[model samples]
Target: MAVAVKKLKSTSFHGHKEWFTEVNSIGQLHPNLIKLIGYCLEVENQFLVYEFMPKGSLENHLFKRGPQGPQSLSWEIRIKVAIGAARGLCFLHEAKPHAIYLDFKASNILLDAEFNAKISDYGPSKAAAARKYVATGRLTAKNDVYSFGVVLLELLSGRRAIDRKKICTEQILVNWAKPFLGDKKQLFRIMDKNLKGQYPQKGAYTVATLALKCLSTEAKFRPKMAEVLATLEQLVNPKMTHFVI
Candidate 1:
């Protein structure tokens, strides 16, 4: 069942058409990605019919505060989400024809009623690819890994990507976090206070360490998306086989 539909932007109508063509070319059946049921071009409308997510974006879940407030996503669930997203990224990166996810952030991850994550914003993702080597290019598996790292940090620290007071210029969360993540002794200082010491310390440490690797300053240093998936799988299933990153 598709949820709300919005009109396409004037600047994006042409790009949207191109996106639709590319999506149709790929033929959607990816489990981790959102499915586009149909589109209407006659009306100059670009609507993507997608499964409804009652809980909305992961960004809201992590940052929003209300009566229903951003629930403290459990360590188990966070790890699950990490693996799920990694699976999605692996599919995108290694699958045929090689489609690259341009922008994958907490905001684009949608949660179904069951809280299973589905990566959305698929078709238009190509625009992200075209810009890859360009000065303005933003799409790359490494870039996606960077975004994923931010989400991972959010999971561990229960903090937003940017915290203003800690350092200058609204304090970039990743930079402030690097030194701490590298040091096992300084690890606890960055853990989410809300986690209440509930997570397995070593497991949490492993995850935080992985997140740092994903956010490496040199894109070449970041582990491949497949490796990331394997790592998270190892964290969850102790007996599962994995290669060292």
Candidate 2:
């Protein structure tokens, strides 16, 4: 297995060290979490080591399709990746004392050889230790939920969260897609055309609804990570005939 080393500058050493320590203690136990193999903290040097992911971040696969051709992620694999990442978030939010992943984004979700998604860059418990210090309301699990919803949008549309290259009103992925989420016909219009009409229509609509819920303007309306996981589980289960909401 390969290893990823994150070296911190001397100026940011102390804060990063504390963050590493927090993750080392609380994040290593989960299967879906990137294992903190070890760390180095010498006088002026600081570094964090983690298991290297072969397929790289979900962001790469989702938006960075190279000059070769269109390499879009299939609907089935996208759902699988979503479920795995959600499980990691569920574990963190349900842990004793509860941990908030303040920086949950597409770049933080890595993929293994089989394209199995694993959450990385959770930093430390101290990252969101103070609720009042957060710029967005409170540092709570719902914050992560909202970020996860953005990632879900990325998966569905294969678009960047913020694409300045696009024209105005279409630059922000969520804002451009939000208006279509409630309507099934409009939802299909926003889906990745690379998918080429191969995905399950009903399942896609279900996930679109879930993503909208996760992106709720009010945090209270966002489903808990556990609830999100359950919904994803049902979406991906082959035997699931009927889905609720």
lDDT of 1 at 194: 64
lDDT of 1 at 166: 62
Please list the C-alpha lDDT of all candidates, in the order they appear: 0.73, 0.84
Q: What C-alpha lDDT does candidate 1 achieve relative to the native structure? A: 0.73
Best TM-score goes to which candidate? 2
**lDDT per residue, candidate 2, 75-138, as tens digits?**
8899999999999989988876566887889899999989888988775544555344565655
**Alpha-carbon runs more than 4 Å astray in model 2:** 15-22, 125-137, 239-245
Worst 10 residues of 1 by lDDT: 236-245
Q: Report the poorest 10 consecutive residues by lDDT, candidate 2.
A: 236-245
State the lDDT of candidate 1 residue by residue for 81-158, as single tens digits: 777777777787776656667777888887777677778876546645444544464446687777788888987888
Clash totals, every prediction: 1, 0
TM-score of each: 0.83, 0.89
Q: What is the C-alpha RMSD of each candidate to the true structure, in Å?
A: 4.7, 3.5
lDDT agreement of model 2 with the native = 0.84
